[model samples]
Every structure is written in C-alpha cells, then in structure tokens.
Target: MGAGMRAARHYTLALFDALAAAGYDAPERVPRLPIVNPPLWELGHVAWFGEWFVLREASGSHPGEALGNSLLARGDDWFDSNTVPHRARWTLDLPAPGALKTYCREVQDRMLDRLAREQDLDDALYPYRLALAHEDMHGEASLYTLQTLGAAPPAALAPIGQDLLPAAVTPAQSGDGTDAAAGDIAFDGGVFLLGGDQARGFVFDNERRAAPCRVAPFAIAADLVSNADYLEFMRCGGYQNARYWSEAGRAWLMGQERSAPRYWRRDGDGGGWHELRFGRRSALDPAEPVRHVSLHEAEAYCSWAGRRLPLETEWEYAAAAGRPEFRWGRLWEWSASPFLPYEGFGADRYREYSQPWFGTRQVLRGASFATPARLRSPRFRNFFTPGRDDIFSGFRTCAP
Candidate 1:
C-alpha cells in the first residue's frame, strides 16, 4: 500500500509538472472542464482523503461516523469532494502548489507510518487501499487531462505511452503484435462468477455480490478494434451515413461535426491519417487499438460492421475463461452494459464513489495505457457517459 501510494503521488506530481510546462501557472488559469478537477484541488483532496480515512477517523468506526478535524485548516470545506462543488474548486482559496506538496508529503508520511503498524489483512486494510486506489485513479485522469489540454506527457510517462505505438507490422497484424486471437473467440458461456467478493482484497462497492450469472454463448473479438479497421468505416462515410448510427449517436455526430476521432487529422497531400498525442503529432499507427472513441461511436461502428458491443458479463467471462489469448489493458474497452450495481450492492464508507453514478453511465471494462497497473482488473468497472470521448477508451466487437 505504501509503495503504491508513493508511486501514485510521484506520478500525479509529474503530471502537474507537465501542466506547469503547458503554462497553467495558477489554479484558476486551468480550464474548468467538466471532465477534470482543478489540479490544486485534486492534489490537496488526495492528501486529505488519506488523512480523513486513515488517521482522522477513529478505528472501528462506521464510515458515517463523524469525528476529528483535519490537519489543514478548513480542509474539509476545501478538499471534501462530496461537499465541495466542482466549479467552486477554482474559486476557492487553495494553497499554492508548494504548500500542497508539503501537505501531501506530510499526509503520506503519516499514512505510511500508520500502515506500517497495522497487522490485520484484507478487510482491515480497506481504507488504506481505498485511498491508494483513489489516488491511482486520479493519476490516470491527470494524464488524460494533459492530453485534453494538448500538453505533453511527463518524461517519466514516456515509456508507458511508447508501449502503445505500433510496431513495424502490417495493419492486418493482430492486436498487440500477435497473430493469435485475431478474430472473434467463441465462448460456450455457462454460469460464470460475475463481480468481486471479499476474497479479492479491497473490492469496490459496485463489484460486490459475486453471483453466478448465466451468459449466452457469444463470440467476442479477441482484440480491440484497430485504427485501420475504424478508418475503413470512416473512409466509407461511416460518420455521414445515418443508417449506421442510432438516433442519439446521430445527434452527437451532428453536434460535433466530427469527421474523425477526436485527435485525428488528415495527413498532407498523401491523404493518410495522423493523430495528436500529448501535443506531439504522429502518423496514425493502424495496428494500434483505436482509442478515445465514445460508446456512441463504438455502437455506430458496430452497426456499420454488423457487430455489437459485448455485455459486461460476456466481457468478464471471456476475460477470465480465455487466458493469454484475450488481450486487454491497453485501453478501457466500452461494454454494452449500463453502470448498474450488482445484486445486494451496498455503498462503502465513501458513499459518493459509485452510488451516485449508477444508471446514468455506461460500464467500461479493462484499463487503459495511462491506467496505473495497480488499478487494472477485469472486474474493475469504469463508468462514463456515452458521449464522453475525452477519456482513453475504445471498444471490441461481438458477432451479431
């Protein structure tokens, strides 16, 4: 937990450094995008979160138990995400970046000191694990925020981004440079254990009630949809053709006047494609998985290709049942499933985490290239609104 927390902090700090490079010198100067938090607020909140759950709250207390003041003066008013409105983050009198860094270091040191003395395992460490996972999640969001702002990724994260660049292989090459598991992999699909349980340490609230779910025998793509494949749809007038899109998708398409994926641009005279990644423009690697596409876009592509998005159950069953052959963790693959709670779902101490967003979002399985390794899990259900293409997300297809 300590290592993970420390790593997450460093990663987040580096992302802030990237923002500094982009010339966002002050908190209010950072654009107030709905998809992101003010950098200063986010950093302070992460520290306050660990301190709130790990050090301030009494041991053996219920999540709702109100107790203790924060080390930071009026920290709750400033850093409690549940209470603080998103827009207000920019207007608030947040401490300077240097001070936030000091707070983070102090809180981390205290949290680590506390963790070192704990002897219990699994459930006992939930609060600490939650804090780590929370920070890891924000870390990924910070990277995408950089992409959103057209800022370069921090040098420390270059290796992670480089891993996604396509090798010198044909566009028809299989996902991740392997020919195996190219097309759809058929699953017999019987009763499969869906969701996480206490046995899996630090299971999220939405991932509870590990029940046996009966999934239909479905054939799902072994690889995520590649850029080359998606390009075919676009070149064939996929976006212009309403027949390939749903009513909602057509509305979104019409609103954006989108001719290609968010970052894509037509290459000069040759008429090939290139995309902007972290402010650097490069040729579109056809072999790389198409990312930053929304659920609506994925759905439209499926319609054009006579395919469908896999249900979350089908995705999980295949991921668990199919071993080395099923490749993921490159992008957060969108699932057809809505972001709903499992049976017997109960909110954890941090009630705002999952309960509020249920039924209003779509579920995305798997992690992205920007995702922290510690947070990557097939069972980790990521949710976003259907029209949100700002996130590092993609899709795989299922045979109709």
Candidate 2:
C-alpha cells in the first residue's frame, strides 16, 4: 500500500472506534443521528470484510469462516448495509461488543503480520493496498453520516471552524461588485498523466499506473463552483426548467418535490435563501464552492449558464496539472464520466475495492471539507448514485 492508503486505513480504524466510544448505539438515546450500530457491529463489519478478501483469498482460507457473512449480507426479510440501519442489527442477537472488538483486532493482526512476512511479495501489494483504501473511503462516509445525524463531534476530529466559510451575497446581488473574484486557471491540455504514477505509490484499481492521455486544451475554474453561484441558479428557476435538465435529471428533479436547493430557506420578504450549515442558518458564501447539490442539479445549472460540468477525465487532467494548491476541501465535484475500471485491471493485496461499484454509479472528483487532506488526489475516484443529493456535494464547469 502507498503512504496515503496506509494513513487512510489508520484514520478509518480510529474513527470507527471513536464513534463507538462516544456511546452511539443502535437505540441511540440521542435523536437525529442514525441509530449507529453498537460499536460492535461496525467494527466487526470492517474487520470481517478485510479478513474475508485479504487473508482468506491470499491464504486459500474457507469462506464459512468469514466475518459477519450472515449479518452483513442482505437476507430474507430486508436490507443490511452493515454500515447503518440500527434497529435490525439491534434485533439480531449477534456477538457481544467485546467479541466484535476481538474480531477486529484479530483481523488487523493477521493482515499486518501477513503484510510484514511478504514484504518481497511485491506483486500483491497493489491489490492489498486497494482494498485497504476502499475500506478507508467507506469509513470516511460513515463519519459524514454522523455529522448529518448531528452526533457530537469526536474529540479527536479536527475542529470544524477552518472550512466553515462565511456566506456570500447571492449572484443577483453579486453583480454589484461585491463577491469573491473567480480564480480562473488556464490549462494547455495535451497528453497528460491521467492516473497515479505507480512510482509514486499505491493507487486504486481504476487508477492503475499513470498512462499518457491526449486532450484538447481547456480552462477550469481555479477553484470549485461555490454556494453563491449555485444559489443564483435556484433564484433563476434552474431546477424547474426542463429545458436545462436531461430526461433522467428532470425525472429525478420532479420526484424530489423541491423548488430551491436542498437545505436552503427563505430569509424574508426581501431576503433570498440562506442555508443551514451545521444546524445554524448562515448566509451563503459565494466564494466557497457550492455544497449539497446533485448531478441533476449540476447539469441543470450548467445548461442554464451555457456551460457544462467537466468529465472525470477532464477533472483529472486539471487536478493533475502543475498547480499545487487547487483542491475544493472535500466538496465533491460533479463529473460526466460513469465509474469504470481501467484497461487490464487486477485486484491488489486487498480485493473488491474497485470491483463492486464499477459502471453502476457516476464518478465525482475532489475530496470534501470532511475528507482527510492526505487522501485528496487528482486521480481519486468517488462514485455515488446520481440521485443522491444528501451528500454535501457540489460542482464546477468548463466554459462552453
């Protein structure tokens, strides 16, 4: 695994422990947050999942011995992400919290020992590292769920004040010379290194060894599209206009029964929509890239503005370009590419990180405000259902 991947694994493992220690349980005495699985379920699920592919397959172990195989998979009556949905897990009468902790410890020990013994097994490193990175990413998602549910922030988590930007005036108001200036970045696109340089370290299955890709020249906004720009779309009826939305995009829009952006509320007779950030209402920060928008919303706004969202390859092309300081602090960027594996892809030390989600979901680029900075990379791939508007997501566009 690469240094970044290892850091992610350590980071994910720590967060899961923190959630459990914080006393978030299935029947959480607290409200709003998910009935987080008792520390037992989540920890085991992560460990079991790792043990199943990494050790079992690598050593030719049997499947029956796998962790949470019965509970993690969906069964006769309903769904089980093993990630959340507390009531059912609480009903299962599974292993005690202590037992589950033991399982996670065992899995971690085995994986570490195996990794150490096979330091020379250089070929396996790629897949093994991939799986760890996969688990690490999911771990980050679980944290976002905690925030959405308003679980008290973990004491160890970095403070929230840094990225929580000040609000910007609405675009209608912004034209009067009162807005953060756009950081326009120009790119002389040509043949570029499209993925990770294996020489640099571990990379995802989809982003294998970096290879050259040719592209036409394009310019990207120096930073991501911010909340202020998106609010203008809401004010201009961007979401409501079918002319600006694709058929699938429009269908999803109508179903939401939403008029303005999600989480936005009116200020008054004269005031425009203000957003609720971490529970309190805050004026929109036009300087910050918009968050909480979906692909449909992104496309609609792109159409309305006579622009288009960048493709995943285009996003990679931009991020991988020479500029060093250009990430959108965890606010995911909408991209046009569907998620898929690269040519001649193979599993690394860890398996299934990139295999399961390929082709089923759309890809977004950039880590969010919630993402660990070390995990952010131009070639990193993030996939989600197109209709998932719940993530604090946003997008930027290339000039038409």
Candidate 3:
C-alpha cells in the first residue's frame, strides 16, 4: 500500500514537473477543458480525498459519520468534487500552485504519520488503498489532458514510447510463436464469479455483490485489434459505410465527420498513416494495438470484421479463466455491456464514485498502459460514454 502511494505521488509530481517545463506552472496556464479538471484543482481534490476518508472521517468509521474539520480553510468548498460544479472550478479563488503542492505534502505526511501508528493492517487498509487508486486515476487523466493539449509526455515516462510504461505480451504468455493479435482463443465457458468480495482487498463499491453468472461458450480474439487491422477497416471504407454502424454510432459519425481515428493522419507522401502522441508525430506501428478508438468505432470495426464486442461478463470470464494464450493489460478494452449494478448493490462510503454513472456509460474491462499495476485487475471495471474517444482504449472481438 505504501509503495503504491509512493508510485502515485512520484508520477503525479513528475507530471507537474513536465507542466512546469512547458510554461504551465500556474493554474491560469492550464486550459479549462470540460473533460478534465484544472490541474491545481485535481491535485487538491486528490489530497482532500485522502484527508476526508483517512484523517477526518476516522478511516471510514461509517458512511454518514463525518464530523471532523479539515487542516485547510475552506477545503470542502474548494475541493469537494460532488459539491463543486465543474465549470466553477476555474472561477474559484484557488491557492497558488506552490501552496497546493504544500497542502499535498502535508496531507501525505499526516496520512503516513497515522499509518505508522496503526497496528491492525486489515482494519485500516481500505481507506489508504482507495486513496491510492483515486490518485492513480487522476494521474492517468493528467496524462490524457497533456495529450489533449499537445504537451510533452511526463518526465517519468519513456522518451520514445507513448506509455508511462509499456508491458508487452511475449510469445510465452500468448502461447504462440507470433504476437498477441495473431489469432483467436476459444473458451468453453460456464458459470463464472462476476465480481469481487472481501477476499479481494479494496474492492470498489461497483464491483461488490459477487454472484454466479452463467457464461455461454464463445471464442474471443487472443489479443486486441491492432492498428494494421483498423487500417484495413478504414481502407475498405469502413467509416463511409452506414451499414457497419449502429444508430448511435451513425449519429456520432455524422457529428464528428471524421474520416480517420482521432490523432491519426496520412503521411505527407500519402503512403502510410501517422499518429500524434504527446506532441510528437510518427509512423503508426501496424503491430501495436489500436487505441483512442471510441466504443462506437469499436462496434463499427466489429461489424466490418463480422465479429462482435465481448460482453463484460465474457471479457471478465476469459480474463480470469482463459489460458495464458489470452493476452490483455496493454490498453483499456471496451466490452459490449452497459455499466450496470449487480443484484443487491448498495453504495459504499464513497457514494458518488459509481452510483451516479450507472447505465449511462459503457463498460471498459481491461487496464491501459497508463494504469498503475496495483490498480490493475480483471474485476476493475472502468466506464465512459460512447462518444469519448480521447482515452487510451481499444477492442478485441468475439465470434458471433
């Protein structure tokens, strides 16, 4: 848990350092985007979240039992995400960037001081783990925010690679002589446990109510669809064909009026495609997994290829029960399931985290390259609306 917190802190600080390098050292310098929070606000909110759950709330003593004060004046007013409307964030009288960093340091110090005195590791594990996961998520958002602004990649990331850290699936892991996207893997599916329990430490509220789900036999792609695969789709007029798209997809296509994936363009010679990654443009690696594709685009590709997106249940079942040949954990993989609650679902201490977005967003089942290792799990379900293509997302297919 401590190591995870350190990693999150390091990455978050490194991103701020990158911003400082790019003349984005102040709150005013960071653009106000609807998709992301102000950098200063994000830092403060993450710190306040730790303080709220661990320090002020007495390590999640109970759901509605919050009765302590914050170290910072107007911390709740400035940082409570549930209360503070998104647009109002830029208008607030926020502390300077240096002051926000000091607040972050103070919060981390206090949490660590308390952690040092605690003896029962199990009793106090949830709040700390929750804070770590939250920080990791915001850190990932900061990266994409940088991408959106065409800023440099974080100083902590690899200079040449698009990821903070790229984890590749070797031939041994894929059980094939070729790359992960080579072929298909069949699953003779049956009953599968679809969620987490107390046995799995720090299970999210949305992942509770573990129950048996009967899964049908299906064959899923051994790996995610690659850029080369998507290239074929585009080459064959996949974007122009309305029959390949759903009603919502067609609407999105018409709204976007895009002929290629976001951040992609043909070379000047008109010979090949290139993708923009963190302010750098380079030739697309055909073997690399196709990312930044929306769920609508993934569905369109499925139609073009005569396949289908796997259900969230099927995705989870395969990830948990499939052979080593089934590769994942490179990019966020979209599933053909809506984000819905399980039977007997109830909100946890952090009520606003998952309950509000249920049924409105699509389920993304796998972790992306930007995802922290500690937060990566087959049961960890990420969600976003169908129109959001800015995230590090891709898809594989299941035989219909």
Against the true structure, what is each candidate's TM-score?
0.92, 0.76, 0.92
Best model number under TM-score: 1
- The digit string of per-residue lDDT tens for model 3 on 199-247 reads 7468888998888888877788988999999999999999999999999
Candidate No. with top lDDT: 1
Better of 1 and 3 by lDDT: 1
Of the two candidates 2 and 3, the one with more favorable TM-score, higher being better, is 3
lDDT of candidate 2 over 4-113, digit per residue (tens): 54565566557655565556544333343342344445555666556665665433123343334433343212222423355555455555556655666666677777
Model 2 lDDT, residue 204, Cα: 65
- Candidate 2 matches the true fold with a TM-score of 0.76
Q: In order, what lDDT does every prediction score?
A: 0.81, 0.62, 0.81
lDDT of 2: 0.62
Q: Give the least accurate 10-residue stretch of model 1, judged by summed lDDT.
A: 166-175
lDDT of 1 at 43: 82
Worst 10 residues of 2 by lDDT: 169-178
Global lDDT of model 3: 0.81
Tens digit of per-residue lDDT, candidate 1, span 1-400: 7788888888878877778778774677899889877777888888888888888863422344546777888888898877788888889988888998899999899889989988778766888998899888888888888888888888866755544421121111111212323487876667767787567588888999878788766788888999999999998999889999989898999898897899998878757989998788977889999989988899999999999999998888777663465788888999999999999998888888888999999999988888776676777899999999989999999988
